[model samples]
Target: MLTTAEILRKVRALEIKSKKLTTDLFTGEYHSAFKGRGMSFKEVREYSAGDDIRFIDWNVSARFGHPFSKVFEEERELTVMLLVDVSASSLFGTIIASKKDIATEIAAVIAFSAVNNHDKIGVIFYSDKIEKYIPPKKGKQHALFIVRELLSVQSGQKKTQLNTALRFFNNTTRQKSIAFILSDFIDTGYQDALRVAGNKHDIIGIKIYDKMDRTLPKLGLLRVEDAETGEQKWVDSESKLVRYEYEKDFFRITDYSNEVFRKAGCDLLHVRTDEDYVKILQRFFISRNK
Candidate 1:
């Protein structure tokens, strides 16, 4: 649990960092990646040398006796939802920051990015069940409120059941939204729910992980407890077979998650806790534009 003062202080720091990243790096990429509802006609203008012939207004051109183009602008009103996982597994970290910490930062950045683009932002915090739902709204205040909640929100349950969150999100939000799911994705059996959400909304997954999740250190025998289930087990990390199995399990989970997103027609990005998430996000946005 975080003290009120501590939460406020961290929220302030995150606000500054997220806003800076949004302005200096993400604004343009985010805008291009997640487009508006559709294009609306603005007016008609005289066609220029390079203007597309397809847009030529036949009536306007006939009346003016010259080629005229129908100008249109993107209707840039969009809703962005952050489906954040607050499961116990997210607390595990072996490097600079915990998975939860990185998820919060990235969520803040995404909120600011959406706000900058004049879009509404909302959040759905979840563990094994729906923890909280912040309705979508526009303005900096709403975005800031989301940042604060992301830092302070807690869940009663430690397990992760993504289907619960996705179903709740679908029920609450009727309009198609740009939804980002931030999680370590340590659970399974959510494929059907994910596919349903993907059909209705634009879904993207950001998988946050730690280095230790992929490879265990050779520290001889050690007792480890399951963060979610509270199950305890002893394992000899020094044994090659034990280390191999640990690594294999990690990859197996990764592969399942990858396949789920791929089959659902959604994009998924992996960010190690210690790696540069900014670069990964930038690349993703740029690739979407292409």
Candidate 2:
């Protein structure tokens, strides 16, 4: 647990980092990437020479016997939901930062971007079970509160169940939203839920990983521990066969995940802990806008 002073300090640091990121990278890209619901009808206006004939208001035109056009306003407000994985696997990292830290930082950047664009942001923290849910809201204070929670919230357990989180999100949010699921994706058997959620929401998955996850270091014999299960085992990392098998497993898992995302019609972005996340995010936003 963090003391009050410690929490305050962390909050301040995250605010500075997230605010700078939002301003520098996402200001324009985020605004143009996603759109709200369909436009709403506004007051009619006199038809211009080049106005579309399909939008002509027959009632108003007939009343005055002059061409009039129906005007519509774009719905500017949007809802952005961050589905964060707080499972124990997020604690692992062989790079500059842990998976949890990367997830938290990315979540903060997206949340700040959403608020800057006058959109509501929400979060659903899960670890096999739902830990906490902060409903959709707008403003800097809300974004800061979410960052605080990301840094401090404790899960009741330390396991991964992506299906549970997706089911909960599907049940809770009735309207369509833009949702970002940030996780290491160590678990399986969530394809159906993912498909369902993707059908309703604009869903994107950000897969956080470390270099060591793909290949084992030539450290001879080493004891490995599973973060989620707390299981331990000794592995001969120096052996060629062991390293080959490890790389094969890594590729298999990644390929399966990619196929699932493709079938669900959801976008997936992979980010390593030691890499620059800002560039990854900027590319994603630009692609989304395109």
TM for every model, in the order presented, reads: 0.88, 0.90
- Candidate 2 global TM-score: 0.90
Residue pairs with colliding backbones in model 2 are none
Residue range 1-290, candidate 1, lDDT tens digits: 99999999998999999989998898689988977656779999999999999999999999989999999998688889999999899899988999999999999999999988889999999999999999999999998899989989887788998999999998999988999999999999999999999998999999999999999999989999999999999999999999999999999999999999999999999999999999999999999889
lDDT winner: 1
lDDT of each: 0.93, 0.90
- What are the per-residue Cα lDDT tens digits for candidate 2 across 1-290? 78878988988988899889898778888878875445778889999999889999999999999999999987788889999999888878876999988998999899889889889999999999999999999999999999999988777688999999999999999978899999988788999999999999999999999999998999999999988888999999999999999999888888888999999999999999999989998998899777
State how far residue 143 of model 2 sits from its true place (Å): 0.8
Alpha-carbon lDDT of model 2: 0.90
Distance from true location, Cα of 227 in model 1, Å: 0.4
The alpha-carbon deviation from the true structure for residue 11 of candidate 2, after best TM-score superposition, in angstroms, is 1.1
The predictions' CA RMSDs to the true structure, in order, are 3.9, 2.5
